[model samples]
Target: MNDVFITKAFTYLPNEPVSNDEMETYLGYINGAPSKAKAIILRNNKITTRYYALDKEGNPTHTNAQIAANAVKGLFDDKFRKEDMELLSVGTSSPDQIQPSHASMIHGELDMNKSLAINTASGLCNSGMNALNYGFLSVKAGVHKNAVCVGSERMSAWMTADKFNHEAENLALLEERPIIAFKREFLRWMLSDGAGAFLLEGQPREDEVSLKVEFIDFYSYAHEIEACMYAGTEKQEDGSLKSWADYPSDEWLKQSIFALKQDTKILDKYILVKGAESLRTSFDKHNLDPDTVDHVLAHVSSGYFKEGLKEEFANVGLDFPWEKWFYNLSEVGNIGAGSIFIALEQLMNSGRLKKGEKVLLCVPESGRFSYSCALLTVC
Candidate 1:
């Protein structure tokens, strides 16, 4: 059967790296003295440095569209052109605007005159894989000859001094809700800014090397778990969704600005129990065996989650190859949906993959407890 192949991959990380110490200085005093949340989170996550789309004054330096467009342009060479792409799939947790759509913005930025531009949102960290899945299906069905899939995030823009100050002001309320508070603070420190793009083609030349997409399977356990991480509208007591305009007070408006709410408690449980179960089922459905796996590329946000993931793998009786595992959390933090692709790029650049070798890409998104796993083979 003809398969979709990733012909090219590229990633863009804006600006210089920000160390944990620098983040502390930027965050400054929350209540009194220096804020310890950043320090504690950095220490616990084992993240030393992460790139941000921020200037020296801790302001947004670039928009999400710019970052994603940079990555996509990087994939272009003499053999490829913007018009050659039949589909442009963009995924992001942070979008430039809600109306034009991130994909459309990138399309405009790249000046691509033709292509189906699609934006997959609210998939959180798994959104990138979701975008790739769409491109893969489109190409596999002969609907498109070539496509571009990108995941980008400007998380630094969402995390500002004002947001930290707001959290400080509501410290008491947050303290009363430990789980919510943890999620808020953790995400603030965990998320970083970056973008990754892959050029997918329906066929590859005999001499060209490519990462062939074998199969992709997605499973959602949101029904069994509460909303652990989310943004946008909130449900009202009457079971109707509350519109942004419905908020009549300054306090409500303040809380609604790119609001990201999470229940750390449920997130923890979902990662350990439900997440593992879903992954095992996906593996079974795809006939992915641990022994045949050559590399494992995962998007784990923190050391805490990494430990939980290890436990989950063991629980499912999957022998994880620690030596073959690749991750970039320590250097790049978590770029949400971009993490897995970034790691995959790193693996490809490592020159370890050989023809017929299989690699597994695991992306667990907490937006609504969805997990995406893809099995790819080197060609």
Candidate 2:
């Protein structure tokens, strides 16, 4: 049983930061018109600037693997060599291709000299943590001297107007249903492109403050719950999901079957409730106290949930003052699987952490209602 430590943290956000008004320019207009749901969604999510891997023509400037590979590149310096890495694990909501695994694609982009072990964890936000947890275990078990774990998203490609134009047109002809139309465009305004990577080593860095991996645990309620957020499938009237393969290829365009979606009612209802339960259970199992935490990094899809989440935590005795919280979503948007690591990078760069302090990371996934939390101690 060896101990694991995070020696380095780095992030790569592609291109210039696109402001609220500039999103449509790069993403293009749906149905030859600006998104009517844009302003309202922006107001609720409160994201001011976000990154995209697309050029002005809505063509991809970087693949999902490229961004993750770039983040991995940032982890190396004069003291480190790419070949020294024993493992590479990447997590993402979107992959460059569905055939090859995302990690294999990222590994292909890197300049590593020898064969590298790679793992891909795909899902919603927890995918990154799953990758991290895999890296953590590999390092802890002495199987790997060092591992690079990444969480990234190339959401812009899927969010672009052309992807949903046909469905938007069909809906307009069927009826005057703004709510359903808004649902289709909702994720477009909420997600962006970014990658965050952490270098896990068996020993702590002596020159700089290292984050000691205390524990990484996940709680899932998939058996007791149905999907709240998802893609590649449509929720049937009976609340069952119908896979894309089950539908004809032509029908995929008519309904935009691959669009990222959520049952907002379920998200708003169970996210906090289930998240609190997940936190409380993990805390009790680990014998942790909320008051003992120095900094809390929470990955939430919207800023609208920040305060409400605090209230929920308070109900479960995990209350902490607002000042101890750290998040960077307003400036970066929600980068899905990469969010928690991105927040950690920003918090560490803020120079606020003191040696021996504790940083708790909370990542909740509405895709089937799961939660992941990690405890890190500044060393």
lDDT of 2 at 237: 82
Stretches of candidate 1 exceeding 4 Å from the true structure: 24-33, 113-121, 164-180, 205-208, 233-246, 253-257
Candidate 2 lDDT at 62 equals: 98
lDDT tens digits, residues 1-379, model 2? 8899998899999999999989999998887887777898899898999999999899999999999999999999865688788899889989888869999999989966699999999888999999999999999999888999999999999988888877877777787442335556788889989999999998988868689999999999999888988788999888899999999998898888999888887888899999999999989999998888999898999988999999999999999899999989999999999999999988876788889999999999999999999999998
Model 2: colliding residue pairs: none
Highest-lDDT candidate: 2
The worst-scoring run of ten residues by lDDT in candidate 2 lies at 175-184
TM-score of each: 0.90, 0.97
Worst 10 residues of 1 by lDDT: 176-185
Decoy 2 TM-score against native: 0.97
- Model 2: lDDT equals 0.90
CA deviation > 4 Å runs, candidate 2 = 172-180
